[model samples]
Every structure is written in C-alpha cells, then in structure tokens.
Target: MICCLSSLSTCVANLELKVKKNIIFRSGSNDLFKPIAGFSILLLTAWSMQILSIRFSQLLFIFFVLFALWPVARKAWRKSLEGNIFSMETLMSFASLGALMINAVHEAAVVLWLFHIGESLEHYATQRARAGVSSLMAIMPETVMLLDDGILRAVPVSQLKPGDEIEIAPGGRLPADAILQDSMAAFDESALTGESLPVEYAKGQQIYAGSVIVDRVCRFIVTSEQGCNAIDRILKLIDEADAHKSPTERFIDVFSRTYTPIIALLSMMVMIIPPFFYDQPWDMWFYRGLAVMLIGCPCALVISVPAAITSGLAAAARRGILIKGGAALEKLAEIKVIAMDKTGTLTEGRPTVVCVITDKPDDEDRVLSLAAGVEEGSSHPLAQAIIRQARKRFNDYPIAGNRQALSGQGVKGDIDGRDVNVMAPTFAPPFAPDSILQGETERLQDAGLTVVVVALENVPLGIIALQDTLRVDAKKTIQALTAMNVDSLMLTGDNPRAAAAIAGQLGMKYQAGLLPRHKVEAVYLQQIAAPTAMVGDGINDAPALRAADIGIAMSGGTDVALETADVALTHDRLAGLPELLHLARRTRTIIGQNVTISIGLKIIFLLTSMLGVTGLWVAILADSGATVVVTFNALRLLRTEKTLPQMILKENS
Candidate 1:
C-alpha cells in the first residue's frame, strides 16, 4: 500500500509540472511567441496520435486545427460584424473551415501556420526599417549643462530656453542650435550632415545640434527654443514624410478592397454552379471551391508596394538622402528637367578674394584694407571674404565709422575721415576709367569672378575679384544627369556674363538675372514641358523650390529652404542625386514586378483550381510561395549597390 501511495505521489508531481509549463506558455508576453508555440504543440500532438487510434487521431486533429484557426476566425468575425467582410482574415478563415469540412485537417493546419509566419516576418521587416529613423531621434541626450549665473548645473533639455548659455563636455553632443562662444574646436558633424571630415569652427560661428565636440571643451549660446532644434525639425519632417502614401500603395489598397469580395463571389459560384451543370459529386466541386478560395488570398499583392517603398526610403536615409515620402521618390524618378541655383547649388557659395588689382599697383594693400574696414561688421558672404583677406594681409587697420549698407549695392563708411565705398559693379562704375582696370574687370567677369570695386572719395582705389568655385563633383554630376536624359539649367540673379561663364564650364544652360519671382516663373516654364526638380540652398530659393515638381535642398542650406524642399541631400554634394534617382527608378521597377508576379500567379492558380488540375496543397503552395517571393524581391532594395551596376554601365556606354 505504501509503494502504491508513493507511485501516485510521483504521478501527481508530474501533472503539477505539466500544468505550470502550460500556464507559462499561455501567459507569455510575446503575442507572436504564444501563437507559434501553441500551434507547434497542437500540431505535434495531433500527428503523434494518428498511429494509436484513428478515431482519437481525428479528434486531436480537429482540436489542433481549431487551435490554429481561433485567432484568424475571431478577427474575421469582428470584421464581418463591422460590415467589412472582405479582409485577408475572412478569406483564410473560410478556406480553412472548408478544408476541415472535407476532412483535410492537416492541410488546414499547415496553411494557417504558414500564413501566421508570413505575417510575423513582414511585421518584423517594417519595424526594422522604421528603427533606422528612430535611431536618429535617439542620439540626443536627455540632460544638458546650463551655465546659470556663471555656475554649471545639469538640467533637462526641455527646460533650457533660447539665449541661454550651455557648457558642453568634450564628447557631448550639442543640445541645441547655438553660436560658438569663447572657444574654438573641431566638431564631428557627420551625424547631421554625413560628412566624415571634422569641421573646424572658431568663436562666433553657428553650430547645429547633433554635432559632437571632439577635442576640447566648448561653450555656446543657444539660438533655438526647446524642442525646436535642427534635429527635432528633421525628425518631424521624417515622420510627416513617412505618413504620406505613394500612388502604387493607394492603388493596391483600392485593388485589394475590390478584389477580395469578387474572389469570394467567384468561389461561391464555383461551389454552387458545377453541381447543376455536371454529374460530378457534390464534395468534389466543394473541395475545388475551397482550393480556389485559398488561392485567391491577396496577401502578396497587398504587401508588395509598401515593403519596397519602406526599404527604399530606409536605404536612401542611410546614404544621407532624405526622400520625403514614397510619392516624392516616385516624382524624383520622373524628373526630366533639373533647375538648379547658381550659388550654393552648383558652386561652393563661399566667395573668396582670388585676385586684387590696384590702379597704382603699390596701393593694393591700402585698397583691400579700406574695403575690409568698411565690410568688417557685415555678415554677407562677400563681406566676410573681404574681411578674411584683409586680416591675412594687414592685421591692424583703422576702423570705419558712420557705416551704412546700400541695398543691392555694397557698403559706405568713413575710413581715416575719408568717405569710402565698396560696391558691386552694378552699383557703380570703375572709379577711374583706365583701360587697364576696364580690361582687368572684363577678364575677371569672363572668368566667372564677381568683381567688387572700392572707391575712395569718388576715385577708384582698386577692384577685388572674388569667385565662388564650382564644387569638385559639379561636372561629374551634370554629366550623370545628362546621361540619364535629364536636362540641367542654371537660374540665378547674377549678371548674364557671369552666369554664362559658370554654365559653360559645366555644359549647362542658363537663365541669368532672375529675381525670386523670375526663378518661380522659370520653374513653371520648365514644368510645362516635363516634370522639373529645383535644387537650392537659400531662403531666396524657397518659392522656386515650392513651384517645382520636386525640390531638393542642400544640407547646409537655410532653414526655410530645408523646410520648403521635398528632398534633402545631407551632405553638400550632388553625388547623392544620381543615387537617389537610381533608387527611385529601381523601387518603381520592383513594385511593378511584384504586382505582375502576384496577379499572374493568382490568375494561373485560379484557372488550374477551377479545372480540377490543382488540389488543396497546390493552392496553398501558390498562395504562400507568391508571398515569399514578392517579399524577398522587395527586400532587394535594402542593398542599393545591387541596383547601381546596370545604371553605371549604361552611363559609361
């Protein structure tokens, strides 16, 4: 009796352990893990019982089939109660239940299991793509050091206001957009601009958020409000861009909505019509109708477009190109004419004093000194260039007083009690009409130099020739665009001679002396022929950028330009433009291929199933196989290098 009692105790212990394991599996936090684990357990139990007893095996099979079908059935029922009955869940539910009715329980279980697995895989891919953008937003620190009352105190970034002084540790990222103060250092701006080189900045220069201080401690005065930093703005743009759907995505959504119900109606007809016309058994046609229903599921077609678009967007973002959305990417592929700004788009935008000509030849230093003193306080690019040159030549100079800025002209001030003016050539003529100076001015203008004339008391002191050099890749970029059959044009407010000179070097057409309004009109004219893209990096280009079909902005561009643009190149280079266009075209091609594969497979399987040439397992293979193929094909966009070889070879040819 004691031995029997000990054996019973062992049996109770094993049962308790089994119950605990079952509870843990059912209560797990992962929604996907629970369904997958339960399905596997039920499938194994059902298959194992088949050798013991046929009756018992059938019961276990039915039990497991229901176990796998519960979630799909619940979802379909909910959708049906809401009067929206043509979802994927509804089709899958009907197919599986029909299979069960025909004693095809094993097939029913395997189909639902495969469908769930596909759903999980697609969800994971989408989440991974979205994580790439989310990682950008996570780079900012939650706390920052505030220099309050000359003392350092740690505070939340949201509490820091504009105009506050902040101290940054050597390796800390900048908390907000700021102006460098009291120090100079090299910064790693790669996170923001994707430029690998460390940029050197001195005191009084603007520093954007997300820049890391690499070498020394720095202090900066904040220039932007809390939550309004450059990174914040970029994140906002990314979010808005992701929310906008492409034309293909919208079409698929509509097609799926209309297609699902039609398939259901067809399946019903296949089940009911054959018995009336032929002498075939009822169960035979019923089974065929079930196979038809399984084959008609629109899983592959519904997921194909979005998967490719999301992958394309993520790939572009990794390469420092911000495509606003799938629609913008689609538009980019169709761009036939590229209207680009002269300064900051094709050229460096930083004009430097390349040549200095003096009437007396010995007074070059004096002419530059006077011009620099007058331009000392101005923030214009040309003014800064003059000041930089003056500091290099003469470290000490007399300060100018009573300074006044002339709109579109240059500046006027009192230097050594003499009225001095430094102006553009359009504002004033050469002080002395000497043939040598006139010839020099013409020569410089022909060479694409912006000649600034300096006059002392209405007499010309000399002319300072400044030039905004073409970007290193400007010619190559133009060639690539031409190879792609995209016509390139330069639109600028500068003189026709200078514009022509620059355009000639790049082999592009030019429309010179364009005001902001004129640039808008030019974009409209270009768009009349074909879709146009406007590339610019200044507030003046905002209107024109908005007018074009696609607007691309340089990363170092003004905030207004960035805000107005539909696409942004994170590095101030045109090399990314070709890659972006390539990606868009490849994405379009993949989407087309996916749609064709999905619809073609469905049509073939539908015909075969109706003719009784395909059975339940074959229908399942068609549905699952098409889904897998389309998904994997769409994922090819994640490796953009694979898409460039053919395009590169074509360009070389």
Candidate 2:
C-alpha cells in the first residue's frame, strides 16, 4: 500500500509539471497574435472598470496588463539567457513591468500597444524595400519548353541540363543561358542589362537567361546547368552580400554592443540615485527611470546602416550594376582615380577606318569602292574593315573578278577591266620621303593607324587609316567622372602611339606597353596617391582588377575578368560607371542622415524623460518611431533614381 501511494504521487507530480510547461509555451508562441488578443481584453477591462467595484476592477486591470506583458518578458528572458541581457526587448519588458508596479496599468498597456504598432510598421517597410529583390525572382520562368526528339514539351526548369535544346515563345523568358540554334530573334534584355531597347541576336549567338523573347519563337541549345544561370548568379550575390559588411555598419554593430549595456546600467543609476541621495519620492523617480530605459533602446541606431545598404544593393542590381556588397559600394564612392583599360573598356575591341586620305581628295570614295570590291571575298581583319567602311558610304559596290591573295601583301583583283590592289603601305608608295603620297602615308602611320593603300595598276591612289575606334559613350563617361572630381587614366599593353592617340582624344593620362604584372603595379602605385579603381575587359586584366581598391568589369568581358571584378557593368556601357558612383555617394549620404536622425531623437527623449517632462508614450516613440523613420529613409534608395523596370512600367502606363 505504501509503494502504490508513492508511485501515484510521483505520476501526479510529473503530470502537473507537464501541464505547466505546455501552458508556458502556448502563451509565448506567436507574439503578434497574443499581443493583439491581449489588447482586446485590456479594452474590455477598461470599460468594465466603470461599473465594477474598485477592488475587483483593479484586479482585472492588473491581470490584463500581465497577460499582455508575457511575450515581451519571455523574449527578454530568452535573450538574457543567450548573454544579450541589454536588448531592446529587455528594456521594453522592464519599462512596462515597472509601470505595472507603480499602479500605472493604463500607461503600461498603451506603451506595449504602441511598440507592437511600431514593429508592424518596421516589418512593412523592410518587406517593401525587399520588393525589388522579390521582383528579380519573378524574372525566371518556372517552366521551360523543352525540345525532346523534335517534340515540344513543357518541363520544370530544374530538370534542364547543358546541351538540351529548348524553344521559347514570344513574350516568354529564357529559363537558362543558351545559344541561338536556328532563327535570329529580338529579345528584351532589360531585366539583365537595364537597357530599355530590344537587342537583336543572330543565330549562334549566346543569350543570357531572364531575357524576354520579344519578336518570335526561337530554338536554343542550353549552355548552363540547373541553378547556374545568370539570374541564379545574381541571387547568390545578394545572399552573400550581407557577409561583407561596410566599415560603417561594423562600427555601429560594435558601438551597440557596449552602448546597450551602458544604457541599462545608467537607467539603474537613475532609478536609485535621486530617491536615495537627493531625497526625492521613490515612486516618481522609479517611473522616470523606466521612461529612461524605454528612451535608451538602440533599435533605431542599430538598424540604420544595414537598412540603407540592403536597399542600395537592390537598387544597384536593378540598374544592371552588380556590386559585391556594402564593402565594395563604400569603396567605390571613395575612388579618386579610375584606371581603365583602353581596348574594350574605352574603345571598341575591333579596328575601323578613322580617316580616308586619297591622292586626290575627290577620289576618296572611288578609292574606297575599288578596295572594298577587291577585298570582298577575304576573311582578313583589314579586308573586313574596308568592306564595312565601303558599306557606310556606298550602297552598291563594284564587283571584282579573278581575286588573288597576294600572300603577306594583301589582296589583288580586276574591277571593271582595270587591275586594283589593296595592299600594305610598305608596298604601295612612291618610296620617296619627300613625295606627297609617301609623306601622307608616314603621317598616318605615326598617328598609330594601320595604313593600307588602294592602287590602280600599281600607282598609289590613297591610304585608308584604321585603328580601334573609341566607344560612343567614352567621352560622356569621362566628362561625367571629371565633373565629379574623379580622374581617369588609360592602362594598356598597346604601343605608345596607339595609347597616346586614345588618351589625347579623351584628355587623360596613359601608361602603355604594360604586361599584366605592370598593370597590377600601376594600380598599386595609384592607390598610394588616392583610392583607385581598375576597369578592364580582358583575361590579361584579371590580375590588375584584383589588385585595385575596386575592380570594375564589363559583363561582355572575358569570364576571368568578370569573375575577378568587384563590380560588373552588365550592359557593358561606360555611362553606367558614373551612375554607379552616384548611387554609392547617395547611399553614404543617406546613412549619415539616418544615424543623425536615430541618435538625435534618443538624446532629446533621454533628457526629457530624466527631467520628468515626458512619460512612457514619448519614450516608446523615441525608440520605435525613430526605427520606422530611419527604415523608411533608407528605403529611399530603391527609388532615388528610376530603375529599368520602373522606367518600362512608366512607359506602358
């Protein structure tokens, strides 16, 4: 009988403990739902207090306040156990409980209610700022039209593998990076490139994923495996951006660690010192101290930097400028000198005729027409340049007959029963230094041009000077950078004359004949003078790009350069460089504004609370309201300048 009684008592005690644990967890879960429920009960208690007896009504009010305080207190306790005893929740928990101890039940209820409201607003602002990143997710198509054994079938994008042929319909986005197989089509690449115009692609050209098929149905051979497409790469960058915090954000984080605990200790001193030493009323002094704790919550100060950085990153991505993280963005704004590669960075990577000097000025067009005719069948770079130049001036070119490749010299053929030759300047001149034709040819060569001559029956007609032409936006980009007080320098492996010609045209300095190692050394030397950025578009530039303060690459550049760069201009436009710098500067400005707003409000409320001029309502506002304001201020980056999608939407609307 004794053993049976002891076993029954142990079982009952275990059951009671289990019930208590269940009750505690149930009340603590889903903080928002319970607080809302508790608020409704508090409202009912306030109304019933008018009719009920004083003692019963007082009990009801106290019970309602405790019910609302449970979640806040539980969160504070959990944080304390994790060694974060001075968090914002801890301050709020103590403040509300202090109000309850002082018989300010209504004030306590209002403070918690206001805290919840402020939290909801902060949540909404964060979600809205993230809306731009969410829109990028929608750019990828969930289903793809797979070409299986020449039969079209809809399949999940995840099942796609390299070398699989797929067909995309008009208005459909590509599911993966692919090569155009059969038909040429126009695609809207705004999602990837941020250009509002539709780019036309030829057969065999590579098209990135997320581009919308604008004109017609097209077949493509997938080149990327699942989860390795362009959009996937972008999403991965965003996911990793947080790990690279800016210096400002790191300082704020470190500052908050010591700041929170100091505030907690100071609040304690405020509660005890005045009542004991100054002989003030204990109740009033304690109330003022609770108000001080509420005012000292670092919610606003802690969130200020990251909120701006997150919004700035999303904004930059929308503009087709991929900055690795806040660290890179912050570095970009500090750049005073931008060292840029000449070929493919400031100029087109291919040669084009810049000047046409004919033996007789009137015969320039005639000379070019004959040269284009003779070089029609040649696949040489110089031959293609002549043909491209001729097409720009004359629509119909005279046909050549019996074309012969003059090994190492150039091409020769008969145009309209007359023999014409397009050969290197070494073979087509009068051979006299003083002769007009010879002098002109040497002058063109001295200007870094590849001088090729067109001859009729071995008599020099004219020389066509060719070199890689400057990009259309090169001058505009340089001018914008100059206006912003940033200097530009050209770094290239090309000969001195070629580098000088390009640098002269743009009014910038040049360092020519550099190997990859020399370029890296140049970047290092420039960094000593001021923060410098290196922009390049070739595999040889990868080393220098990695060595700069910030490495920027054109997306159309070699894979090595793109991967090594800290920032990539996806549209491969120089104009985007200035825009990126502007964004960075704006982000820094907003961060400063946010910090000032957050800390300034706290200082005001802290002083007012200690003087007993403000109570819990103003104290909570100083903390939570400041958080909402700074968050919304940081969100301004999303719309500071119109993004590609915003521009497109505005046009349609």
Candidate 3:
C-alpha cells in the first residue's frame, strides 16, 4: 500500500504541476489550485507513513484523514457559519469524516479525490464555453484610420466619436457604424450579419461596425461612438444572455440543497437505529452507515445538469446558433408553434419594382420620376424599390423638397413645384375619375404586390407595384418545420390579401395588417395553443419576439431585436431554425438520460449499502462510476454533427 500510494503521489504531483502551469499560462494563476495540490500531497505523505508499521498505522491513518479533510472542513465550516449549511461541500465533508470514523481511510481518500475531480471538470467545462464567446470579442480592431485635419492619422477606436470620418482600406474592418462617403464598395459582413456573401453598399448608405471592406479603399463618416457600435453591443448581450440559468440547472440546485441534510440525517439514523432496534454490533452498523453516506453522496447528480448544458451550449455555438443558455435551448425544444414576420424573416427584405402600371403608356417615365423624387428622402423598403426602378429608367430626376413620411401611409414632398404624394391605396385620398387605376391597384395587390399609388395633388399619377421576394429556402424551411410537427404562421403589417397570397404560396397560416402592438397580441394568442416562438429581423418585431416563449432573431436583424431575442441564427438562414430545434430536443433527451442514470445508480447503491451487501470500496466505486457515466453521456451532446448531417440531408431530400 505504501509503495502504491507513493507512486500515485509522485504521479499526481507531476500531473498537478503540469496542469497548473498550463492553466496559469492560459488563463492566469487560479488561487484554488495551490491549496488543493498541497493538501493532496499531505494526504499522500500521511498515508505513506502509516504503511511503514502496523503499530503506527491506525494513528497515522487518522492523521491522513485529517490532512485530507482540511480543505472541505474549512469550506463547510465557513458555509455553515454563513447560514449555508446545506451545501455540497458540507455533505462531502461529513461523508468523508464518517468514513474515517469507520476506519475506511482508503474509501475516504477516494471520495475526496473524486469530488475534487468533479469540481475541476465542471469549472473547466464552463470556462471553455465562455472562451468560445470571448473569441468573438477578439475580432474587434484596436485602432482605426481617422481623417483628422485631412492627414489620415491612425488612432485608437476609443478616441473615435460620432461624425468622425474614417478611411478603410481594402480588407480592413469598419471600426464603427458609419455612412459611406465613397460612391460604392463591397463588404464582407459575415462577422456581424453572418451573411457569407459580400454585400454592396452605395454612397450615403449606413454600414455597421465589424464589416470588412472587401473591394477598394473607402471612407465613411461615423454614426455611432466608440463602445456603442453593433459589435460591442453584441458582445455585451451575449455575456448577459449566457448568465441566465436553465430550468434543469435550477431544479438540480434546489434538489441538491435540500438533499444533503436529509441524507446526512438518514446516515445518522442508520448508525443509531440499527444498533439499538435490532441489537446489531455497533461497529458493524456504524461501518454500514458510513457506506450509506458514501453511496448517497450527491456528486454525480449535482454535476450532471451543468455538464450537459455546457456541452450543448458549446456545440450550438460552433454551429453559429447562439442559444442564450440552457434554459433557452430547453424552451426552444418545447416550441410547437413558430410565429414569423413576413419581411426579412421569410423573404428578402429588399423589395424591387415588379411592375410599373401607368394610366397612360407615355406618362410612365414622368410618374415614376415624380414618385421616385418624393421617395428619395425615405428609407422604407418599398420606397427604395421605386427609387431603384426610377434610377434604372432615368438617371437625373428633379429633387423633392419639404419631404416628410406619413407613418404607415407613405411619403409626401414637393416635386417640380407640385405637391406629390406616394402611398398605399388604402391611405390614398378618393379619386373619382380613376376607376382604371383603381382596378389596376386591386389586381396588383391580389397578386401579392405591394402597390404604391402616386398622386399629384390628390389626382392619381400611376401605380408602382413592388414585392419583397420570398427567400429561396423559405418553402423548404416551412416544409421541414411541418415535418418536425411544428406549426408555422406569418404575422405581418402588410395588407391581408398580400399576406394571404404569400402564405398560400408557402402553404402556411398568416395574420396580416398587424401593427407592432397587434403582432404582440397575435403572439400571445398563439401561445394559448402551445409553446410558441417568434422569429423576426426588425425593430417592429421586437415586442412580439419578447412576448413569445422563445425569441429567435436573424443575424441581420436590428440590435434591439437581437438583444431581445433568446436565440440568434448567426448565419441568417431559416435552414438553421429546424437544425436548432433538433439540437435542442436532443439536448433535452440527453439531460433526461443523464439525470436518470445519476439518480438511479445512487439509489441502487444506497439500498445495497443499507443491506450490508456493499462495503467502503464498492460504495466509492459506485458513486464515482455514476459520475463518470453521467459526464460522458452529457459530452455526447458535443458531437451533434452526426445527427445534424442526417437532419440536413432529410431537409434537402
């Protein structure tokens, strides 16, 4: 025993030193490692001394137990003094000390060793998950090119303010959200929006921070100050979201807190009641009680929940799905209904002019130019579509003055000394002699086109029909969701006819003409049927997203939407939605399996200990074995690629 313990001690010491050095070099020195290492060595030394002679073995073994007990003793004592007597440390300290009282020194040593290993594993797993998120923060550039006094000096990003003009060379990242000063440039927005392809931005367009300039050198004026850009806010939101605890974790915490004292009391009863009631030998019953304590140690059950959750979180992060925490992942699995916004969520948010209907064929250019001039100052998707079509037809158009937006209606301005208004048909004033234009507008709306009625002082000019094209993968995504037995619905502020037309194409339900508040109400109504998830990519959907059981935001969504959502599809693809749901369901199933194994094994071992069928070594082995099984089972969640590929293949088929 002395030779074996000495070799183990030397091995442990060398291993500890190597691990400590690696940890310190990677994450700075941790204070807890030193004491654990010191006490571990002390326990080994005391055990070695005991093995030298039988005469001194008993006394030295007691000393060995005390040396090993010090750290747990201090922790349990401090927690007890602070009114936290029901902690796992308290349970462990009592259990190990009880083992020593029964003269099972080896069992006590093994118990403490296994407990320490479990703690280390839990801590390391958590740190690894956090490191995955911290890597995103590392992408931010420290300095940026500032065009100060036209000299173009390199300055720290922290010194940048809104309105500052910064020069970005090709292949450089944008340090802040800014308006483009150059005519046009292509950018790789994958870091921010998760869009794999390069996006082109015209002059005066707003580009966010973290976008890489992929084309020629460009200059832009900053719109957001330092520390307030999209990338900075994303990092902050991830930190906040990751801190939330899952339901399973919370239940385990409460269960463990209540479990320790009850088990300790049961061990005490086993020591006292059997000796008195059955006239059993006191030493025999006492040893059995100690074994019972070892068997009932809640180490396996306590560590199981977090191990599985952390593994699931890390796996999801690797796939570009940012589930806020284990709770969000669990909730995602329970979502039976998914309420989605129409624009940006199911379709490309960028609208294009699909048809230009004019009352007179020759006046097409005039009507388009007048509507485009009024919409030039507007940033709405439909407005941009008209402007794009106008630019394609005529390069130079009269500029509009006194431009103003009519909330939920359209834009109004003075173009060529005449009052021009561009709006939806419902928001347009009555036109008595325009039955032909009215008929055309109805026909376009019925075809799912968003018609913009152009009027010159209440006299209709023509109808410019625009439509937000459905995503190529939208039908496939809906079909996949259906195959998973999940219902899909579209909630939009567009006209009911248009909304129904798109929904019919996708073969899903829809609630149209919904304002922001109406969307929230719709989400709440859907939740009555089953657990619901709201997916969107705009500020208007933020409220509805918050109202649902789980909020999934697109990567290209607004910061408010992203911050409010519980899950983010970083790749900005609906294809990831079904994949995320599948992962969440698998994670829940794994957690259930882990909890069952941990608890079931402990119960079986506990019964055997009470019947005197198991001894100290067997009890220790059972406890440690259960922990190892649960941990490995949880780690299986990290290799979810096997399941994900099948899911993708099925979706493709």
Candidate 4:
C-alpha cells in the first residue's frame, strides 16, 4: 500500500528552510509550527532507533505519538463534546493510540503523518475549487478614475454610486458595471465572458465589471450600485451553490453521518468480541481493530462527490456558463431533449425590414411611415424594425395619436387623423384570394418572412415582410446535440411556414404558433419521453423556462428570463450549449469515478484489515491516499476542455 512515501524529516526540513528564507511560508509561520514540530519528533525517534537501546527508542516513539495526537485530540474532543464522537479526527486518534498500546510504534507514527498529509491535500483541493471566486475578486480595481464636470479624479470603487461617470485608462479593469459613453470601445472581456480576443462595444452598451479596457481611454456612467455588478452576482451565486447540493452530494452527506458512527462501533466490537469470546490473542485482535478504525475514516467517501461538483461549477464559470449550483449542473447532464425558443435562443432576436409593399409603388414609403408612426415608442422587435426602416427613407414619421395594442393581433392607432392599423395577416380582415396584398403575404410567409398587413380606415394599404436571421452557430449547435443523441425542438409563436422554415434549416422538430403557456405544454410533452430543458431569452419564455426540468437563458435575455432559467450562457452564444453539456457530462463521469475509487478502496482495505492481512499503517495509508487521489481526480475537471477538444467554445461568429 505504501507504493511511495516521502521522508517526513526531509520534507519538513525543506519547508523550514523555505520559511526562514521568507519565501512561501513567511505569512504562515503559525501554520508551519505544528507540522514542523510533529515531523521533528519523528526525526528524533528515527535517530534514537539507530544507536540507542530498544527501550529508549520505544519511549521516544511514544512521545512522538502523543505529540502528534495533541492537535487532533483537541479537535476530536471538541466534536465529541458536541455529540459527534465518530468524527475523522476522533477515529484516527483512537486508531493511532490503539496501535501504540499494541507496541506497533513505527506504524502509529506513519499513520498520523499520513493522516495529516491527507488533511492538507483535502484543504488544498477545497481552496483550489474556490480559486475561481478568489481570482475574480482580484480583478476589480481598488480605485477608479471618476469624471465630474470634465475633471477626472481617482476615487475608490466602493465610493462610486449609480449614475456617476468614470474614465477607464487602457489596460485598466472596469471598477463597476457601466454604460460606455464613447462612440466605441474595445475591451478584453476574457476574464468575464471568456472570449480570447477583445470585444468591441458601441456607445450605450452596458459593459460589465472586470472587463479590461483594451484600447484608448474612454468614459462610462456607472449603472450598477456597489456590490451588485457582474462579478458580485457570480461570486454570490458560487457562494450559494453549496446550499443547492446535487442528489449525489446530498446522499453522501446523510450516509457519512450514520456510516461513520457505525464503523466506529464495529471497530470497537472487533477489538473486544474476538479477545473476550473467541480466545484470540489480545495484541493481535487489538492491532486488527485499530486497523479497522483507520480504514473506516470516510474522508475519501465524504469528499468524493463535492470535490467533483465544486470543480465542475468552477470550470463552467470560467467559460462564461453561470450554472447556479451542483443541482442545475447535474440536471443539465440528464437533459435528453432541449426545447429552444426560436426568437432569441435559435435566431437573432432582432428582425429587420425585408421589404414594404403598397397598393401603389409610391405608396410604399407612405405605408411604412404610417406603420413606424404607431410603433415609435413600442419596444416590440417588429415595431423597432419598422422604425429603423422608416428612419432610413424619411427624416421623421408623423406621430400617431391614441395608439393601442390589439391582443394577439398587432397595433392600431390614428395617423394624421386617419385610422391606421398594422397587424398580422391572419388578424387583418380577409383579403381577396388573388389580390396583391394576399399574394404578397403568402409569398413572404413562404419565404419565412413575418408579414404584417397595413390598413388605412380598415382598407388594406400594403404588406410589410420582416425576417430574423438565424444565428451563425444555430445549425452547428443543433447538429452537435444530434450527434450526442440529444434531440432539439423549436417552439415559437411564428406562423407554421416560418417555423417550418427555421426548423427545416436546423433539421429539428418544431411546434409552431405557441403562446407562452403552450410552450410550457410542449415542454411537458417532451418530458414524457425524457428529461427536457428549455432554452429561451425573452419574457414570454419565462413560463416554459420554469416548467421545464432545466431552464437555460442567454445573457442577452430579459431580466425575467435570466432569473427564471437555472443556467445562463453569459456570452450570448448558442455554441456554448455543446460546451455546457460536455462539461456537465464530464463532471458526472468524474464524480462517479471518485465515488468508485473512495468506496472501492475502503471495501478492499476493510476486508483485508479484518483478516489481519494489513496493519494500521497500511490501512491509514490506503484511506488517506484514496482521499488525495479522489481530490486530485476531481481537480482534473479544471482541464476538461483538453480531454474533449470540441468542448472548448469556438470563437463566436
């Protein structure tokens, strides 16, 4: 079992030298004192064994065991006082002292040393799991350049409030989430969104905290209050992630609480029952009993799931996939079907004016102007598209008066005292089957363009066709999901023709003309066959997002959508879906491997120790070594991208 063991005295001597040189342990002298002292005692015991009498070496070994047990004994006694008597430290203390009582002095020393090394490895793994949050905290600048009345002054980031303007020097991190005031700015958002290259944001775009200003100096108006920026939210989520434990992690917690005490009781029984009833030698059975206690520490078993879960969460966050917790990450891997909303999830949510047809060629401009007038203040995607088109041809559109939205239809208002209505073709009055308006509506729909009828005094004026382009990676993402044996389904309120057009292009299933509630129903239907995940990025998608087994939202989505979804692709790229899935599946695999390693080793050593095949030193070495192995195995999730080449996010088009 001791395949390789470093010399404890040599390791401690090197550590002491480093401390004296003020290298890594300069600030950790107090922490170094215990290990240095414990190992030095073992060194002295070794030297005494070389020349001194056996009795003298035995006495020195006893002193070493007692000195090693001092720190562990304090912790064990505290927990025993708290009614948790079978804690890891408690078990190890009893096991090492039992070994000494049986005159296994050398085994006792090695057992405690290995136990401490295992604890240190566990501590290091935990710190490494949380390194993401710590590294992110380091990115925020303590001070920012505040701009006031054309004067720039250095001010603490904490002192900056909402609406305060600040200037960012090139290569400096943004202190808080703010809106860019310059015409355009280039920033290195790799620390945040994980894009390798610098991203360009235009004026009025909201730039998150921790983004490095990569180009020229620029100014911004702080939009986030202190501690509510992008980094703060991510940190808070990671902190709360432990509360939302995965089923595997939760089960391990409950199992360990009962399993530890039962193992302790069995170890005591092994020590007493054999010698008292079976007439076994007291020394032999006592040594085997101590071996049982050491083998049953449960350190590796307890840490198996969480170590992997924590590493998985940190890895996902590094790639701009903000999974809320282990529960969400676990569910993500179980997703057999992913139902995506068409508007924002699959296609670019922005629609553009493809063409405007009118009764007369000259009336095309007039009809567009009327439509734009009513949609001027509207935030609807189609309404904005009309406004954008009108702006290109005319200086301004005549303002519509008494504008109103027709539920499930479109908008109606008065334009220059004439009743103007722009509504979906189906909602508009029936047109002559062979009429130009009807023909144009059918032609647009066939081409996957959303057609709206423009009316003046309830008479058809023209039809405008608008279309939202599919995301560059939409087809590729769907293909990737298909290759993984996960099906994709598109749910949209668009007409059957448009939905068919989009779904056909992506080669996926589709459900058209779905309202928010209908989308929820669709999610339910998908769940009948397998676990379903809903991916969307709009207010309408919130209902389905909540109803689905897992909800994933793009970061560019509405606040409600972002809040409703369990996971957020902060980079706003569909390509991240495959990467997220790969990470989740890999995490589940690593967790399984860790659990198998932990439990398998314990079971094997538990049998061997009971038959007196392995002594206390080998038992503790196996248990502590398994703990370190599982931890380092879990840490491998940090490099998952290397295991699966395609799991890395491709540069967004």
Best by TM-score: 1
Q: 90-195, model 1: which lDDT tens digit per residue?
A: 9989899999988988888788777766665566556555556567778988999999998999999888888999999888999899999965799988776555
Q: Which tens-of-lDDT digit does each residue in 401-461 have in candidate 4?
A: 9999998799999977889999988888777555688877888799788889988898888
Q: How does residue 310 of candidate 4 score in lDDT?
A: 91
Assess each prediction's global lDDT (C-alpha) against the native: 0.82, 0.82, 0.79, 0.84
Q: Count backbone overlaps in model 1.
A: 0
The TM-score obtained by model 3 is: 0.81
Compared with the true structure, model 1 gives a TM-score of 0.87
lDDT at 355, model 3: 81
Tens digits of per-residue lDDT, candidate 2, 482-512, equal: 8788999999998888899889888899999
Once all C-alphas are superposed, what RMSD does model 3 give against the true structure? 5.1
Indicate the TM-score of model 4.
Answer: 0.86
- Using lDDT as the measure, name the better of candidate 1 and candidate 4: 4
| Best by the lDDT measure | 4
Please, what is the TM-score per model? 0.87, 0.80, 0.81, 0.86
RMSD of 1: 5.2
Which residue runs does candidate 3 get wrong by more than 4 Å?
A: 1-64, 167-235, 238-243, 313-326, 358-366, 379-381, 400-440, 453-462, 471-473, 515-521, 537-543, 553-576, 638-653
Ranking by TM-score: 1, 4, 3, 2
Which pairs of residues have clashing backbones in candidate 4? none
